[model samples]
Target: MKPSGGSAPGGLFSRLTGFPAGTGGDGVAALSKRQWTRLTAAHQVRAVVAHRWAVVVLALLGAAGAGAVTLAQTPVYSSTVQLVLTANYPAKDIDQVSRGSNYVLQRINTYATIANNSGVAKAVIDKLGLPYSGEQLMANVTVTTHAGSTAMEISVRDTSAQRASDIANAYGAEFPAFVGKLETPDYVDTAPIRVSVTTPATVPAAPVSPDPVANVALGLLAGLGCGLVLAAVRYARVRTVRDERHATEITGLSLLGAPAVDRAAPLLGADRAATPAAEAFRQIRTNARLRAAGQRLTSIAVVGSVPGDDAAAVAANLALTWARAGDTVVLIDGDFRDPSLPGLFGVPNGTGLADMLSAGTPANHALQQVQPELQLFLLAPGTPMPGSAERLLRTNELTKLMESFRRDGAFVVLLAPPLLANADTLVLLSATDAVAATTRVGFTHSDRLAAALQVLQAIRANVLGIVATRP
Candidate 1:
């Protein structure tokens, strides 16, 4: 392993495969067909539960509104006259024209006309003191003939049912005299449409114009239609990345072992309550050992493309893991601007690398032994350090530190600041043997990622690949 100047792909595996593949490609997410199915299924359920109820309520309201609108319209009343055709043969007959049902049928229409004649209607109007004309009366009335029968019925409608019925019966009573005037008079109407005094209209218990129940039903149907429409619209607009297969499509990355929600799995969530930074450390620890083929000891520096990576947390845990394997592992927090390892490990933040570089503090005093196996060296960013910290890796002291780790066969994992945000991490990479890049899932943008990856390629960094972190 050597210092990567501009990120490059080189590992024992890359060499053996003879096809050096970088960790990234042209940023594009191709949605899979199967994922589309899952997305629609979830979306359909959500749409039904959310919008269907609203559609129902809207339907009900629409029905009520329609009923009210109808109620506001003027009412129309109707009356019907049922005339029973009596066999009133006038006892004068003696011809073929007078005996057949056709003759009787032909004569019945005359009765329908006689039933609605101006002479009879006017007399009834005069008797009843009506306001409308006989012609108007006839206009409001319909005389319909029953099929294959010698009978016809007349119905009239107005704003008042009682008045309609009264007019009908009065005009009906006047029909007998008018029939006598007709040359072809045949029969008499014995019955007519009339209202019972006992059932006089009293503003009607229920309205005659609008039916609320039916209106409600119609509204509900309309609401149902609307709900379905909205549901379909939402169904078509769904997107998802709910599983590992989808994650692959979005990132164009290989399926490295995913951390199961269960932290207690073989190499998963060993610390359930741990921060995201700590989780990355565990993943990298597994990746370097199990993912790599050989048993050779490796020193991988953790770097991210942006700050607030909690990279120091990862270094601390990773170093602990190596030390647990009976190797003395030193975790170095190299971020001079915002040192975090000291606070993360509950160690003293005062008198660290910064103190040593500026105040001549001994390395032994600045070094904090967290465990018999693990040691943490918090980088102190004092006045002299911040100004020349980018060149800190160039010092003889840093070279001595690397040599000491090599001699003891102890692993040294340095936590570097993000290269994209600060120059400290990229500069420190020159001193590191390999780079373990941490990329935050769903946070890092593609353009910035392409730039960072390009740097690693330029630096020829021993690209140990990536650690995908979920916070």
Candidate 2:
């Protein structure tokens, strides 16, 4: 039968065929920039969510560090004194009052500068008998003015609340006298402008610096940002397949199914009929059947994209799934390098595929019946033929054996080694009617999977789809 396209099934097999007919380039390269960005951002968010505990831990560390620094800092108390500049000449009319207000507003900035001057700081330091120098006292002084008003504010910070209040009040008292001396000009008795105290400085009840709450909050924000950046970098640097979508994108094949990892029961045994792993294998069987609707798919080569993908278990379960449905299934351990089906099924490793290809052993004599109730048979990798396994598989005996199984209406499931691990896998795949590629989530590197798919495509092998096993 010839390979033909059909309507895709719903759910796991809904994704379109990724690779084009001739080109082996990126399957998602056709997407627009905006769509690609959204897709990448979605993956990044998922990665961050997967490592949320790390982010939380980093944020807490940052907050604790900020809180510690805040505690170690010296406490500083702040005090402010308010002053107003007014016209010394009595205003006779509304226009005169408006002119006086404008003049004060124009000079308010100058007065604010004078309030923060080193001379004023020196005078305040001398009057209060403080130990600080003029430059040191001026560093802690701040002056501000109100726009369109005749108000100026003088603030001072110090380790002692009383000293801060004294410094601010001293500026309020001495600034007017200093202005008077400068403005009187030795011609008039009083200065043209008068500076009067509007609000006297008060001792602060609490220190303004070393705010623990604000510091911790800022630190938490900064830490959270840093955590997100690190998470994104880690996600970008990761080379393994993240999920089923990632597997599909890499292999450019429809996702057959993902079997949940069950450490307690790795194989789908007869006692574990109702388990999710069994159901997943059954789903994979169904999808494989649907994918090969028009073609003859009696023999399937289960090949892993990379090492440790557990392709042997996938092949065993898949064969068991088909046999449980009343179909005669022959499970062959095609991987002579590392034969696992004998240990998996508790069958003795005797004369099997190796003997059949080299010594021309009868297929029926080499086949072992694993399940008595079900029509399931196992062909163990008989004898350790290390160097000649590839040469044996290249012979036509393998093809004839598969044909004999197909002729008997039995489904042959061959457990082949990883594509990148052994060269015999290509020979096994060529003998089989179809191939079922397996990948382990978070274990199979995407680039390795792509390379395997390219090799399969180069040989024009019939790949059914991908089966992702999640741990």
Candidate 3:
């Protein structure tokens, strides 16, 4: 029996989600709260980074949209004029001149605010005969005083560059007169303080708003941020079985090995030349031997979820590899629905597995040699028994066949039907000693693989590992 919960490798997510251990009832692993949280974050981030094309496309579209919006906005121009404040009081000494300069500097800040006031706005607007009122003109006007100096600046912004310059110069010309009248006494003809324009406003050749390069850059940044968020969301929702890592993580199965797709690789190991698929099969055979050393695993079932998962290829190559290593191996085509062993090895499927099981045919007469010199044997599906295939597998005939193969000192490798395709292979699970699942890279879905694992767990089958077919 599986334990309730601990630090066991298999039940990591199921514990947190209240699902049974080693089952995909809730589509979650049997993990503790902390472990589940950590795995979720890491897995989601990995998925997002794995599919970066979606993120790039979204980012590009976001940047293009922002650039289009920036181009649609109206451009604005700003013009500025500078003024200097000076005290007219006659100074007799150097100390008096210093004191007068300090007074002028202190009054500059006050003059800056007064320059943008409604009174100055009305005066400037009336002199220029502008269409706007005092309040409206004041809305576009701004005044700033330089630090530790008697200099003040008046700025105006408008859609037209000439209008912006006219408004700025008008404020500069009117503020000095407005200050002079306000500061002068009732009987005095002259004022103690005066303001003079240092730099006149000029019409700007370029607009300040709607900078194309800056806007496009900002849009790119925003778009990239949005794309990463979208990628993370997509990764969290969709679960696709892409490689061995995902297969092992979701199914709690060991990673046997990944075999490369090489059409030049033959079914039997008669060709001594080393190929990627051959080397991979040799390694998988070693792993299976190590796994079975502790248990009595004589009958091995190689199953897949889909038709193109290469389960038959894995079983045939693995049997040949073991036979080449001086072990007597028998490869059985257990999938009567879609028998592939005869076609794969170019053998006649006249007198094989179905005949041996149904007619009490002797194994010596039914088994076909993969090659005359090799100890590898083939038990291909003899004939199509579509209606009674599941019943034949469910009976004691399969168990007796395995017993007979075990007595002959032959390791049996069965290529069963796909788990999702039909339930014919599910009937043979009772007699199978160990199981290995095969999945095609970038083709199988995680949900179907999880369901297959759940069925294996339900039947209490010994899970050897998983074989990933690299495209």
| lDDT digits (tens) for residues 420-461 of candidate 2 | 656666678888889999989888766656767766776789
Best candidate (score: TM-score) = 2
Tell me which residue pairs clash in candidate 3.
11-30, 12-30, 12-31, 13-29, 13-30, 13-31, 14-29, 14-30, 14-31
Off by over 4 Å in 3: 1-72, 94-106, 187-192, 220-239, 262-273, 384-387
TM of each candidate vs. truth:
0.46, 0.84, 0.80
Q: Local distance difference test, per candidate?
A: 0.56, 0.80, 0.77
Cα TM-score of candidate 1? 0.46
lDDT of 3 by residue, 1-471 (tens): 122211332342233334554454545333211122333555766766866887788778878987898889898999999988888788899998898898888878777777788888888878889999888888888888878989888889989999999999988888889999988999987877888999999999999998888888888888888877777666554545656776777678888899875445536455643877788888998788787787988878999866778888888888878887888999998877678889888888888878877888998899999767778899988874656664566567878899989998999888887765555666565667888888876666676577667667765778789998776
The digit string of per-residue lDDT tens for model 1 on 375-422 reads 434444333443566445445566566566678676778887776655
Which prediction has more favorable TM-score, 2 or 3? 2
The true-structure Cα RMSD of candidate 2 reads 7.5
Clashing residue pairs in candidate 2 (N, C-alpha, C atoms within 3 angstroms): none
Candidate 1 residue 72 C-alpha distance from true site, Å: 12
